[model samples]
Target: MGPITVTDDLARIDLDVVHRWLSTDAYWALGRSRETVEAAARGSLSFGALVRSDDGDELVGYARVVTDRATFAWLCDVYVAPSARGRGVGSALVRAVLEALEPMGLSRVMLATHDAHALYRRHGFGEPAHPEWLMALQPTPAASPATPAV
Candidate 1:
Protein backbone atom coordinates (compact mmCIF):
# COMPACT_ATOMS: atom_id res chain seq x y z
CA MET A 1 0.00 0.00 0.00
CA GLY A 2 2.84 2.35 0.77
CA PRO A 3 5.78 2.91 -1.57
CA ILE A 4 7.05 -0.39 -2.95
CA THR A 5 10.01 -1.12 -5.19
CA VAL A 6 9.49 -2.97 -8.48
CA THR A 7 12.41 -3.89 -10.64
CA ASP A 8 13.06 -5.50 -13.99
CA ASP A 9 16.46 -6.75 -12.96
CA LEU A 10 16.25 -10.25 -11.49
CA ALA A 11 19.97 -10.27 -10.84
CA ARG A 12 19.42 -7.70 -8.12
CA ILE A 13 16.70 -9.77 -6.45
CA ASP A 14 17.22 -11.58 -3.20
CA LEU A 15 16.43 -15.14 -4.24
CA ASP A 16 16.09 -16.36 -0.65
CA VAL A 17 13.15 -14.06 -0.17
CA VAL A 18 11.65 -15.33 -3.39
CA HIS A 19 12.17 -18.92 -2.36
CA ARG A 20 10.38 -18.28 0.91
CA TRP A 21 7.48 -16.50 -0.76
CA LEU A 22 6.91 -19.30 -3.23
CA SER A 23 7.06 -21.85 -0.46
CA THR A 24 4.16 -20.28 1.41
CA ASP A 25 1.98 -18.86 -1.36
CA ALA A 26 -0.98 -21.22 -1.90
CA TYR A 27 -1.87 -19.84 -5.30
CA TRP A 28 1.51 -21.06 -6.43
CA ALA A 29 2.47 -24.71 -6.36
CA LEU A 30 5.24 -25.29 -3.85
CA GLY A 31 8.58 -26.60 -5.12
CA ARG A 32 10.25 -23.65 -6.72
CA SER A 33 13.88 -23.09 -5.91
CA ARG A 34 15.97 -19.98 -6.18
CA GLU A 35 17.86 -21.78 -8.90
CA THR A 36 14.75 -22.25 -11.04
CA VAL A 37 13.76 -18.61 -10.88
CA GLU A 38 17.27 -17.55 -11.64
CA ALA A 39 17.47 -19.91 -14.56
CA ALA A 40 14.21 -18.70 -16.03
CA ALA A 41 15.20 -15.12 -15.60
CA ARG A 42 18.44 -15.74 -17.38
CA GLY A 43 17.01 -18.00 -20.09
CA SER A 44 13.71 -16.34 -20.84
CA LEU A 45 13.77 -14.28 -24.02
CA SER A 46 10.65 -12.46 -22.96
CA PHE A 47 9.91 -10.43 -19.83
CA GLY A 48 9.85 -10.92 -16.06
CA ALA A 49 9.55 -8.90 -12.88
CA LEU A 50 10.07 -9.55 -9.19
CA VAL A 51 7.94 -7.59 -6.77
CA ARG A 52 9.28 -6.77 -3.34
CA SER A 53 7.51 -5.44 -0.30
CA ASP A 54 8.65 -2.13 1.12
CA ASP A 55 8.11 -3.10 4.70
CA GLY A 56 10.62 -5.88 5.19
CA ASP A 57 12.78 -6.36 2.10
CA GLU A 58 10.69 -9.41 1.25
CA LEU A 59 9.98 -10.78 -2.19
CA VAL A 60 6.20 -10.66 -2.12
CA GLY A 61 5.20 -11.46 -5.69
CA TYR A 62 6.44 -12.41 -9.15
CA ALA A 63 5.34 -12.97 -12.77
CA ARG A 64 6.87 -13.80 -16.14
CA VAL A 65 5.79 -13.13 -19.69
CA VAL A 66 6.50 -15.65 -22.39
CA THR A 67 6.34 -14.17 -25.84
CA ASP A 68 7.55 -14.65 -29.36
CA ARG A 69 7.82 -10.89 -29.87
CA ALA A 70 5.70 -11.19 -32.97
CA THR A 71 2.00 -11.62 -32.37
CA PHE A 72 1.43 -13.20 -28.98
CA ALA A 73 2.47 -13.43 -25.36
CA TRP A 74 1.42 -15.59 -22.46
CA LEU A 75 1.77 -14.46 -18.89
CA CYS A 76 2.36 -17.14 -16.30
CA ASP A 77 3.37 -17.99 -12.74
CA VAL A 78 1.63 -15.02 -11.20
CA TYR A 79 2.19 -15.29 -7.48
CA VAL A 80 1.56 -13.06 -4.51
CA ALA A 81 2.47 -14.05 -1.00
CA PRO A 82 -0.46 -14.50 1.42
CA SER A 83 0.90 -11.89 3.75
CA ALA A 84 1.27 -9.58 0.76
CA ARG A 85 -2.24 -9.84 -0.68
CA GLY A 86 -4.80 -6.98 -0.82
CA ARG A 87 -1.99 -4.50 -1.25
CA GLY A 88 -2.06 -4.21 -5.06
CA VAL A 89 1.08 -6.31 -5.22
CA GLY A 90 -0.35 -8.83 -7.67
CA SER A 91 -1.85 -6.25 -9.97
CA ALA A 92 1.29 -4.21 -9.84
CA LEU A 93 3.38 -7.18 -10.89
CA VAL A 94 1.08 -7.96 -13.80
CA ARG A 95 1.02 -4.39 -15.00
CA ALA A 96 4.78 -4.16 -14.98
CA VAL A 97 5.05 -7.29 -17.10
CA LEU A 98 2.49 -6.00 -19.57
CA GLU A 99 4.21 -2.67 -19.90
CA ALA A 100 7.49 -4.41 -20.60
CA LEU A 101 5.95 -6.33 -23.50
CA GLU A 102 4.03 -3.47 -25.08
CA PRO A 103 6.80 -2.65 -27.48
CA MET A 104 7.10 -6.18 -28.78
CA GLY A 105 4.40 -5.66 -31.41
CA LEU A 106 2.25 -8.36 -29.90
CA SER A 107 -1.25 -8.56 -31.29
CA ARG A 108 -2.57 -10.26 -28.18
CA VAL A 109 -1.37 -11.15 -24.69
CA MET A 110 -3.09 -13.59 -22.38
CA LEU A 111 -2.95 -15.38 -19.05
CA ALA A 112 -5.14 -17.56 -16.85
CA THR A 113 -6.04 -16.60 -13.30
CA HIS A 114 -8.62 -18.65 -11.47
CA ASP A 115 -9.82 -16.43 -8.62
CA ALA A 116 -7.91 -13.29 -9.45
CA HIS A 117 -10.04 -12.44 -12.46
CA ALA A 118 -10.72 -9.00 -11.08
CA LEU A 119 -7.04 -8.31 -10.55
CA TYR A 120 -6.14 -9.13 -14.13
CA ARG A 121 -9.20 -7.34 -15.44
CA ARG A 122 -8.15 -4.19 -13.68
CA HIS A 123 -5.04 -4.35 -15.82
CA GLY A 124 -6.97 -4.53 -19.16
CA PHE A 125 -6.94 -8.31 -19.43
CA GLY A 126 -10.21 -9.86 -20.52
CA GLU A 127 -11.60 -13.37 -20.84
CA PRO A 128 -10.81 -15.12 -24.08
CA ALA A 129 -13.76 -14.54 -26.35
CA HIS A 130 -13.57 -17.95 -27.97
CA PRO A 131 -13.46 -20.59 -25.30
CA GLU A 132 -13.50 -23.10 -28.14
CA TRP A 133 -10.35 -21.59 -29.59
CA LEU A 134 -8.16 -22.37 -26.62
CA MET A 135 -6.67 -25.70 -25.70
CA ALA A 136 -3.47 -26.65 -23.91
CA LEU A 137 -1.30 -29.70 -24.10
CA GLN A 138 0.86 -29.99 -21.01
CA PRO A 139 3.63 -31.67 -23.03
CA THR A 140 4.36 -33.50 -19.82
CA PRO A 141 2.40 -33.42 -16.63
CA ALA A 142 3.90 -31.62 -13.68
CA ALA A 143 6.35 -34.04 -12.05
CA SER A 144 4.29 -33.89 -8.86
CA PRO A 145 2.28 -37.03 -8.22
CA ALA A 146 -1.33 -37.03 -9.33
CA THR A 147 -2.48 -38.13 -5.91
CA PRO A 148 -1.13 -36.50 -2.80
CA ALA A 149 0.06 -38.56 0.13
CA VAL A 150 -2.85 -39.43 2.36
Candidate 2:
Protein backbone atom coordinates (compact mmCIF):
# COMPACT_ATOMS: atom_id res chain seq x y z
CA MET A 1 0.00 0.00 0.00
CA GLY A 2 1.22 3.51 -0.73
CA PRO A 3 1.30 6.39 1.70
CA ILE A 4 -2.14 7.65 2.55
CA THR A 5 -3.01 11.25 1.72
CA VAL A 6 -6.01 12.90 3.38
CA THR A 7 -7.82 15.73 1.71
CA ASP A 8 -11.04 17.71 2.12
CA ASP A 9 -11.59 17.96 -1.61
CA LEU A 10 -15.12 16.78 -2.33
CA ALA A 11 -14.25 16.39 -6.01
CA ARG A 12 -11.77 13.67 -5.09
CA ILE A 13 -14.45 11.46 -3.54
CA ASP A 14 -15.82 8.41 -5.33
CA LEU A 15 -19.43 8.36 -4.24
CA ASP A 16 -20.00 4.91 -5.64
CA VAL A 17 -17.40 3.39 -3.35
CA VAL A 18 -18.67 5.34 -0.39
CA HIS A 19 -22.24 4.24 -0.96
CA ARG A 20 -21.18 0.64 -1.37
CA TRP A 21 -19.16 0.68 1.80
CA LEU A 22 -21.80 2.36 3.92
CA SER A 23 -24.91 0.77 2.53
CA THR A 24 -23.52 -2.77 2.58
CA ASP A 25 -20.85 -2.93 5.24
CA ALA A 26 -21.53 -0.25 7.77
CA TYR A 27 -24.01 -1.20 10.48
CA TRP A 28 -25.25 2.33 10.96
CA ALA A 29 -26.01 2.87 7.29
CA LEU A 30 -27.16 -0.50 6.06
CA GLY A 31 -29.55 -0.24 3.11
CA ARG A 32 -28.95 3.48 2.81
CA SER A 33 -29.68 4.75 -0.65
CA ARG A 34 -27.23 6.38 -3.01
CA GLU A 35 -29.40 9.46 -3.18
CA THR A 36 -29.27 9.73 0.61
CA VAL A 37 -25.52 9.34 0.58
CA GLU A 38 -25.18 11.98 -2.09
CA ALA A 39 -27.37 14.35 -0.15
CA ALA A 40 -25.41 13.80 3.04
CA ALA A 41 -22.15 14.48 1.26
CA ARG A 42 -23.56 17.59 -0.26
CA GLY A 43 -24.63 18.98 3.11
CA SER A 44 -21.59 18.06 5.17
CA LEU A 45 -17.89 18.75 5.35
CA SER A 46 -16.37 15.70 3.66
CA PHE A 47 -12.94 14.16 3.75
CA GLY A 48 -11.36 11.40 1.73
CA ALA A 49 -8.22 9.42 2.30
CA LEU A 50 -6.50 8.30 -0.89
CA VAL A 51 -3.51 6.26 -1.87
CA ARG A 52 -1.71 6.53 -5.17
CA SER A 53 -0.70 3.55 -7.17
CA ASP A 54 0.11 2.79 -10.80
CA ASP A 55 -3.63 2.78 -11.32
CA GLY A 56 -3.71 6.37 -9.95
CA ASP A 57 -5.21 7.72 -6.76
CA GLU A 58 -7.85 5.55 -5.12
CA LEU A 59 -10.09 6.63 -2.25
CA VAL A 60 -9.68 4.23 0.64
CA GLY A 61 -11.50 5.99 3.45
CA TYR A 62 -14.10 8.66 4.09
CA ALA A 63 -15.67 10.81 6.84
CA ARG A 64 -18.14 13.67 7.02
CA VAL A 65 -19.06 16.30 9.58
CA VAL A 66 -22.33 18.22 9.88
CA THR A 67 -21.52 21.55 11.41
CA ASP A 68 -22.50 25.16 11.34
CA ARG A 69 -18.75 25.97 11.25
CA ALA A 70 -19.21 27.84 14.47
CA THR A 71 -20.46 26.26 17.69
CA PHE A 72 -21.32 22.64 17.06
CA ALA A 73 -20.40 19.71 14.85
CA TRP A 74 -21.45 16.14 14.47
CA LEU A 75 -18.90 13.77 13.05
CA CYS A 76 -20.45 10.82 11.33
CA ASP A 77 -20.14 8.19 8.62
CA VAL A 78 -16.48 7.47 9.19
CA TYR A 79 -15.30 4.44 7.24
CA VAL A 80 -12.06 2.81 6.23
CA ALA A 81 -11.90 0.26 3.45
CA PRO A 82 -11.05 -3.29 4.47
CA SER A 83 -7.86 -3.16 2.46
CA ALA A 84 -6.87 0.04 4.25
CA ARG A 85 -7.51 -0.97 7.86
CA GLY A 86 -4.82 -1.54 10.51
CA ARG A 87 -2.54 0.98 8.82
CA GLY A 88 -3.39 4.23 10.62
CA VAL A 89 -5.62 5.53 7.84
CA GLY A 90 -8.50 6.07 10.25
CA SER A 91 -6.33 8.01 12.65
CA ALA A 92 -4.95 10.18 9.92
CA LEU A 93 -8.42 10.94 8.62
CA VAL A 94 -9.72 11.95 12.03
CA ARG A 95 -6.62 14.00 12.76
CA ALA A 96 -7.00 15.89 9.54
CA VAL A 97 -10.65 16.58 10.32
CA LEU A 98 -9.99 17.93 13.81
CA GLU A 99 -7.10 20.02 12.56
CA ALA A 100 -9.28 21.55 9.90
CA LEU A 101 -11.96 22.40 12.40
CA GLU A 102 -9.68 23.68 15.14
CA PRO A 103 -9.77 27.21 13.87
CA MET A 104 -13.53 27.41 14.26
CA GLY A 105 -13.15 26.86 18.02
CA LEU A 106 -16.44 25.06 18.03
CA SER A 107 -18.00 24.53 21.44
CA ARG A 108 -18.34 20.85 20.81
CA VAL A 109 -17.87 18.06 18.31
CA MET A 110 -19.72 14.80 18.72
CA LEU A 111 -20.12 11.33 17.24
CA ALA A 112 -21.70 8.03 18.11
CA THR A 113 -20.06 4.72 17.39
CA HIS A 114 -20.93 1.17 18.28
CA ASP A 115 -17.30 0.29 18.09
CA ALA A 116 -14.05 2.26 17.74
CA HIS A 117 -14.36 3.87 21.13
CA ALA A 118 -10.66 3.41 21.74
CA LEU A 119 -9.77 4.92 18.41
CA TYR A 120 -11.91 7.96 19.09
CA ARG A 121 -10.63 8.26 22.63
CA ARG A 122 -7.16 8.66 21.19
CA HIS A 123 -8.39 11.79 19.48
CA GLY A 124 -10.00 13.38 22.58
CA PHE A 125 -13.50 11.99 22.05
CA GLY A 126 -15.25 10.78 25.13
CA GLU A 127 -18.70 10.09 26.43
CA PRO A 128 -20.83 13.19 26.68
CA ALA A 129 -20.06 15.25 29.71
CA HIS A 130 -23.72 15.55 30.47
CA PRO A 131 -25.53 12.54 29.12
CA GLU A 132 -28.56 13.21 31.32
CA TRP A 133 -29.12 16.49 29.58
CA LEU A 134 -29.26 15.01 26.13
CA MET A 135 -32.22 13.50 24.39
CA ALA A 136 -32.89 12.22 20.91
CA LEU A 137 -35.90 11.43 18.81
CA GLN A 138 -35.72 8.96 15.94
CA PRO A 139 -38.85 9.31 13.93
CA THR A 140 -40.17 6.42 11.90
CA PRO A 141 -39.50 6.45 8.20
CA ALA A 142 -42.09 8.40 6.28
CA ALA A 143 -44.21 6.61 3.75
CA SER A 144 -42.98 6.66 0.20
CA PRO A 145 -44.83 8.86 -2.23
CA ALA A 146 -46.17 5.79 -3.98
CA THR A 147 -47.50 4.33 -0.73
CA PRO A 148 -50.77 5.64 0.66
CA ALA A 149 -50.82 6.39 4.35
CA VAL A 150 -53.00 4.20 6.50
Candidate 3:
Protein backbone atom coordinates (compact mmCIF):
# COMPACT_ATOMS: atom_id res chain seq x y z
CA MET A 1 0.00 0.00 0.00
CA GLY A 2 1.56 3.26 -1.13
CA PRO A 3 -0.02 6.58 -0.38
CA ILE A 4 -3.66 5.49 0.03
CA THR A 5 -6.05 8.36 -0.58
CA VAL A 6 -9.32 8.39 1.31
CA THR A 7 -12.04 10.68 0.15
CA ASP A 8 -15.75 11.32 0.76
CA ASP A 9 -16.28 11.93 -2.94
CA LEU A 10 -19.18 9.88 -4.22
CA ALA A 11 -17.99 10.60 -7.71
CA ARG A 12 -14.96 8.44 -7.15
CA ILE A 13 -16.86 5.42 -5.96
CA ASP A 14 -17.48 2.42 -8.22
CA LEU A 15 -20.81 0.82 -7.38
CA ASP A 16 -19.96 -2.48 -8.99
CA VAL A 17 -16.77 -2.79 -6.94
CA VAL A 18 -18.61 -2.07 -3.73
CA HIS A 19 -21.52 -4.35 -4.53
CA ARG A 20 -19.21 -7.20 -5.45
CA TRP A 21 -17.38 -7.03 -2.13
CA LEU A 22 -20.51 -6.59 -0.02
CA SER A 23 -22.49 -9.35 -1.66
CA THR A 24 -19.76 -11.96 -1.82
CA ASP A 25 -17.07 -11.15 0.73
CA ALA A 26 -18.67 -9.21 3.54
CA TYR A 27 -20.25 -11.42 6.16
CA TRP A 28 -22.71 -8.71 7.18
CA ALA A 29 -24.04 -8.21 3.68
CA LEU A 30 -23.64 -11.65 2.14
CA GLY A 31 -26.27 -12.28 -0.53
CA ARG A 32 -27.26 -8.60 -0.49
CA SER A 33 -28.52 -7.30 -3.79
CA ARG A 34 -26.96 -4.57 -5.88
CA GLU A 35 -30.18 -2.55 -5.74
CA THR A 36 -30.13 -2.62 -1.95
CA VAL A 37 -26.47 -1.66 -1.89
CA GLU A 38 -27.04 1.18 -4.32
CA ALA A 39 -29.91 2.49 -2.23
CA ALA A 40 -27.72 2.45 0.84
CA ALA A 41 -25.01 4.41 -0.94
CA ARG A 42 -27.53 6.96 -2.11
CA GLY A 43 -28.92 7.47 1.38
CA SER A 44 -25.71 7.87 3.32
CA LEU A 45 -22.43 9.76 3.26
CA SER A 46 -19.88 7.57 1.52
CA PHE A 47 -16.10 7.29 1.72
CA GLY A 48 -13.77 5.62 -0.71
CA ALA A 49 -10.14 4.58 -0.53
CA LEU A 50 -8.18 4.83 -3.72
CA VAL A 51 -4.68 3.65 -4.27
CA ARG A 52 -2.45 5.02 -6.94
CA SER A 53 -1.52 2.64 -9.72
CA ASP A 54 0.51 2.92 -12.88
CA ASP A 55 -2.60 2.70 -15.03
CA GLY A 56 -4.68 4.97 -12.84
CA ASP A 57 -6.42 4.95 -9.43
CA GLU A 58 -8.29 2.00 -8.04
CA LEU A 59 -11.12 1.91 -5.49
CA VAL A 60 -9.86 -0.52 -2.88
CA GLY A 61 -11.99 0.29 0.13
CA TYR A 62 -15.31 1.82 1.15
CA ALA A 63 -17.36 2.97 4.15
CA ARG A 64 -20.57 4.84 4.75
CA VAL A 65 -22.05 6.67 7.71
CA VAL A 66 -25.74 7.36 8.16
CA THR A 67 -25.91 10.50 10.21
CA ASP A 68 -28.36 13.19 11.12
CA ARG A 69 -25.34 15.57 11.14
CA ALA A 70 -26.47 16.89 14.51
CA THR A 71 -27.18 14.07 16.92
CA PHE A 72 -26.18 10.52 16.06
CA ALA A 73 -24.27 8.60 13.42
CA TRP A 74 -24.25 4.93 12.64
CA LEU A 75 -21.13 3.73 10.84
CA CYS A 76 -21.83 0.79 8.61
CA ASP A 77 -20.87 -1.21 5.54
CA VAL A 78 -17.11 -0.82 6.01
CA TYR A 79 -15.20 -3.09 3.66
CA VAL A 80 -11.62 -3.20 2.43
CA ALA A 81 -10.87 -5.31 -0.60
CA PRO A 82 -9.06 -8.58 0.04
CA SER A 83 -5.92 -7.17 -1.46
CA ALA A 84 -6.19 -4.12 0.76
CA ARG A 85 -6.68 -5.89 4.06
CA GLY A 86 -4.07 -5.91 6.87
CA ARG A 87 -2.32 -2.97 5.25
CA GLY A 88 -3.82 -0.13 7.31
CA VAL A 89 -6.65 0.46 4.84
CA GLY A 90 -9.28 -0.26 7.49
CA SER A 91 -7.64 2.00 10.05
CA ALA A 92 -7.16 4.75 7.53
CA LEU A 93 -10.82 4.51 6.52
CA VAL A 94 -11.98 4.75 10.14
CA ARG A 95 -9.76 7.74 10.81
CA ALA A 96 -11.07 9.51 7.76
CA VAL A 97 -14.65 8.84 8.80
CA LEU A 98 -14.04 10.18 12.32
CA GLU A 99 -12.39 13.29 10.92
CA ALA A 100 -15.34 13.87 8.58
CA LEU A 101 -17.83 13.53 11.43
CA GLU A 102 -15.90 15.73 13.85
CA PRO A 103 -17.18 18.94 12.31
CA MET A 104 -20.80 17.85 12.74
CA GLY A 105 -20.53 17.85 16.57
CA LEU A 106 -22.36 14.58 16.83
CA SER A 107 -23.46 13.25 20.22
CA ARG A 108 -22.40 9.67 19.43
CA VAL A 109 -21.21 7.40 16.69
CA MET A 110 -22.14 3.75 16.77
CA LEU A 111 -21.26 0.59 14.90
CA ALA A 112 -21.91 -3.15 15.30
CA THR A 113 -19.14 -5.64 14.61
CA HIS A 114 -18.86 -9.30 15.38
CA ASP A 115 -15.09 -8.98 14.90
CA ALA A 116 -12.48 -6.24 14.37
CA HIS A 117 -13.20 -4.83 17.82
CA ALA A 118 -9.53 -4.22 18.39
CA LEU A 119 -9.20 -2.18 15.24
CA TYR A 120 -12.06 0.09 16.22
CA ARG A 121 -10.94 0.28 19.86
CA ARG A 122 -7.67 1.76 18.69
CA HIS A 123 -9.71 4.58 17.21
CA GLY A 124 -11.45 5.35 20.59
CA PHE A 125 -14.46 3.02 20.27
CA GLY A 126 -15.65 0.86 23.13
CA GLU A 127 -18.49 -1.25 24.48
CA PRO A 128 -21.61 0.72 25.16
CA ALA A 129 -21.98 1.68 28.80
CA HIS A 130 -25.69 0.93 28.76
CA PRO A 131 -26.13 -2.06 26.53
CA GLU A 132 -29.47 -2.77 28.16
CA TRP A 133 -30.81 0.48 26.74
CA LEU A 134 -29.96 -0.53 23.21
CA MET A 135 -32.27 -2.66 21.15
CA ALA A 136 -32.78 -3.77 17.57
CA LEU A 137 -35.66 -5.05 15.47
CA GLN A 138 -34.40 -7.12 12.58
CA PRO A 139 -37.26 -8.40 10.48
CA THR A 140 -37.54 -12.07 9.67
CA PRO A 141 -37.12 -13.00 6.03
CA ALA A 142 -40.35 -13.79 4.24
CA ALA A 143 -41.20 -17.44 3.96
CA SER A 144 -41.58 -19.00 0.50
CA PRO A 145 -44.55 -21.10 -0.56
CA ALA A 146 -42.32 -24.17 -0.79
CA THR A 147 -41.23 -23.76 2.84
CA PRO A 148 -43.16 -25.80 5.36
CA ALA A 149 -44.62 -24.12 8.43
CA VAL A 150 -43.45 -25.20 11.85
Candidate 4:
Protein backbone atom coordinates (compact mmCIF):
# COMPACT_ATOMS: atom_id res chain seq x y z
CA MET A 1 0.00 0.00 0.00
CA GLY A 2 1.18 3.47 -0.74
CA PRO A 3 1.78 6.03 1.97
CA ILE A 4 -1.43 7.59 3.23
CA THR A 5 -1.60 11.36 3.36
CA VAL A 6 -4.26 13.05 5.47
CA THR A 7 -5.48 16.53 4.73
CA ASP A 8 -8.36 18.81 5.65
CA ASP A 9 -8.98 19.93 2.10
CA LEU A 10 -12.71 19.45 1.58
CA ALA A 11 -12.16 19.49 -2.16
CA ARG A 12 -10.04 16.36 -1.84
CA ILE A 13 -12.91 14.31 -0.40
CA ASP A 14 -14.68 11.81 -2.63
CA LEU A 15 -18.29 12.15 -1.50
CA ASP A 16 -19.56 9.12 -3.41
CA VAL A 17 -17.18 6.85 -1.55
CA VAL A 18 -17.92 8.56 1.74
CA HIS A 19 -21.67 8.24 1.33
CA ARG A 20 -21.40 4.58 0.37
CA TRP A 21 -19.20 3.83 3.34
CA LEU A 22 -21.34 5.69 5.85
CA SER A 23 -24.80 4.85 4.54
CA THR A 24 -24.18 1.17 3.87
CA ASP A 25 -21.33 0.00 6.07
CA ALA A 26 -21.26 2.30 9.07
CA TYR A 27 -23.64 1.13 11.78
CA TRP A 28 -24.18 4.59 13.24
CA ALA A 29 -25.15 6.04 9.91
CA LEU A 30 -26.86 3.20 8.15
CA GLY A 31 -29.26 4.40 5.46
CA ARG A 32 -28.10 8.00 5.82
CA SER A 33 -29.10 9.96 2.74
CA ARG A 34 -26.76 11.48 0.17
CA GLU A 35 -28.24 14.90 0.71
CA THR A 36 -27.51 14.61 4.40
CA VAL A 37 -23.97 13.50 3.72
CA GLU A 38 -23.39 16.37 1.34
CA ALA A 39 -24.81 18.83 3.80
CA ALA A 40 -22.69 17.43 6.60
CA ALA A 41 -19.55 17.72 4.57
CA ARG A 42 -20.42 21.23 3.58
CA GLY A 43 -21.04 22.20 7.18
CA SER A 44 -18.19 20.44 8.94
CA LEU A 45 -14.42 20.39 8.92
CA SER A 46 -13.84 17.46 6.60
CA PHE A 47 -10.70 15.39 6.24
CA GLY A 48 -9.58 12.83 3.72
CA ALA A 49 -6.82 10.26 3.73
CA LEU A 50 -5.39 9.70 0.26
CA VAL A 51 -3.04 7.07 -1.05
CA ARG A 52 -0.67 8.34 -3.65
CA SER A 53 0.46 5.92 -6.32
CA ASP A 54 1.41 5.90 -9.95
CA ASP A 55 -2.30 5.90 -10.72
CA GLY A 56 -2.73 9.15 -8.78
CA ASP A 57 -4.36 9.80 -5.42
CA GLU A 58 -7.18 7.63 -4.15
CA LEU A 59 -9.22 8.66 -1.12
CA VAL A 60 -9.31 5.76 1.30
CA GLY A 61 -10.50 7.34 4.53
CA TYR A 62 -12.62 10.22 5.77
CA ALA A 63 -13.60 12.13 8.93
CA ARG A 64 -15.43 15.31 9.84
CA VAL A 65 -15.48 17.51 12.91
CA VAL A 66 -18.25 19.82 14.02
CA THR A 67 -16.57 22.52 16.04
CA ASP A 68 -17.02 26.13 16.97
CA ARG A 69 -13.23 26.45 16.41
CA ALA A 70 -12.90 27.85 19.88
CA THR A 71 -14.60 26.03 22.72
CA PHE A 72 -15.69 22.54 21.69
CA ALA A 73 -15.71 20.00 18.89
CA TRP A 74 -17.36 16.76 18.07
CA LEU A 75 -15.48 14.32 15.93
CA CYS A 76 -17.66 12.07 13.81
CA ASP A 77 -18.11 10.12 10.62
CA VAL A 78 -14.66 8.58 10.77
CA TYR A 79 -14.22 5.72 8.29
CA VAL A 80 -11.45 3.92 6.51
CA ALA A 81 -11.88 1.79 3.41
CA PRO A 82 -11.59 -1.96 3.90
CA SER A 83 -8.52 -2.02 1.74
CA ALA A 84 -6.85 0.54 3.99
CA ARG A 85 -7.66 -1.09 7.30
CA GLY A 86 -4.75 -2.23 9.48
CA ARG A 87 -2.45 0.07 7.57
CA GLY A 88 -2.67 3.01 10.03
CA VAL A 89 -4.79 5.12 7.72
CA GLY A 90 -7.39 5.77 10.39
CA SER A 91 -4.72 6.81 12.86
CA ALA A 92 -3.13 9.07 10.31
CA LEU A 93 -6.44 10.71 9.54
CA VAL A 94 -7.21 11.26 13.21
CA ARG A 95 -3.77 12.60 14.00
CA ALA A 96 -4.09 15.08 11.21
CA VAL A 97 -7.44 16.15 12.54
CA LEU A 98 -6.15 16.73 16.06
CA GLU A 99 -3.17 18.63 14.74
CA ALA A 100 -5.43 20.87 12.74
CA LEU A 101 -7.54 21.63 15.79
CA GLU A 102 -4.62 22.17 18.12
CA PRO A 103 -4.42 25.84 17.38
CA MET A 104 -7.95 26.46 18.52
CA GLY A 105 -7.12 25.24 22.04
CA LEU A 106 -10.63 24.00 22.40
CA SER A 107 -11.67 22.90 25.85
CA ARG A 108 -12.92 19.55 24.58
CA VAL A 109 -13.25 17.29 21.58
CA MET A 110 -15.61 14.34 21.62
CA LEU A 111 -16.39 11.32 19.52
CA ALA A 112 -18.55 8.21 19.74
CA THR A 113 -17.33 4.84 18.56
CA HIS A 114 -18.52 1.29 18.95
CA ASP A 115 -15.22 -0.57 18.42
CA ALA A 116 -12.43 1.94 18.16
CA HIS A 117 -11.87 2.65 21.80
CA ALA A 118 -8.30 1.43 21.82
CA LEU A 119 -7.45 3.47 18.78
CA TYR A 120 -8.91 6.61 20.31
CA ARG A 121 -7.37 6.03 23.71
CA ARG A 122 -3.96 5.94 22.16
CA HIS A 123 -4.64 9.51 21.10
CA GLY A 124 -5.82 10.75 24.56
CA PHE A 125 -9.54 9.97 24.36
CA GLY A 126 -11.03 8.24 27.34
CA GLU A 127 -14.23 7.62 29.21
CA PRO A 128 -15.81 10.91 30.13
CA ALA A 129 -14.49 12.31 33.37
CA HIS A 130 -17.97 13.12 34.52
CA PRO A 131 -20.33 10.62 33.00
CA GLU A 132 -23.15 11.88 35.19
CA TRP A 133 -22.74 15.32 33.73
CA LEU A 134 -23.40 14.17 30.23
CA MET A 135 -26.67 13.19 28.64
CA ALA A 136 -28.14 12.69 25.21
CA LEU A 137 -31.52 13.16 23.63
CA GLN A 138 -32.14 10.84 20.72
CA PRO A 139 -35.66 11.35 19.47
CA THR A 140 -37.42 8.13 18.57
CA PRO A 141 -38.67 7.85 15.03
CA ALA A 142 -42.11 6.82 16.27
CA ALA A 143 -42.41 10.04 18.23
CA SER A 144 -42.53 12.17 15.11
CA PRO A 145 -46.23 11.71 14.39
CA ALA A 146 -48.73 14.15 15.81
CA THR A 147 -50.49 12.84 18.86
CA PRO A 148 -54.22 12.97 19.59
CA ALA A 149 -55.43 15.59 22.05
CA VAL A 150 -55.05 14.42 25.59
lDDT, each prediction? 0.59, 0.81, 0.80, 0.79
Which candidate has the top score in lDDT? 2
C-alpha TM-score for every candidate = 0.67, 0.84, 0.83, 0.83
Task: Return whichever of 1 and 2 wins on lDDT.
Answer: 2
* 1 against 4, candidate with superior lDDT: 4
RMSD (CA, Å), candidate 1 to true, equals 10.6
Off by over 4 Å in 3: 128-150
lDDT of 1 at 66: 71
Candidate 3 weakest ten by summed lDDT: 132-141
What is the alpha-carbon lDDT for the whole of candidate 1? Answer: 0.59
- Residue pairs that clash (backbone atoms under 3 angstroms), model 4: none
Task: Score candidate 4 by lDDT.
Answer: 0.79
Off by over 4 Å in 4: 128-150
Instruction: Report the Cα RMSD per candidate.
Output: 10.6, 11.7, 11.8, 11.2
Give the per-residue lDDT of model 3 (tens digit) for 61-102: 999999998867888999999888999999999999988987
Give model 2 RMSD, 1 decimal.
Answer: 11.7
Poorest stretch of ten by lDDT in candidate 2: 132-141
Which pairs of residues collide in model 3? none
| Per-residue lDDT of model 4, residues 50-81, tens digit only | 99977788999999999999777888999999
Q: Tens-digit lDDT track for model 2 on 22-85?
A: 9999998999999999999999999999999898999999999999998777888999999989
Error (Å) of candidate 2 at residue 47 is 0.4
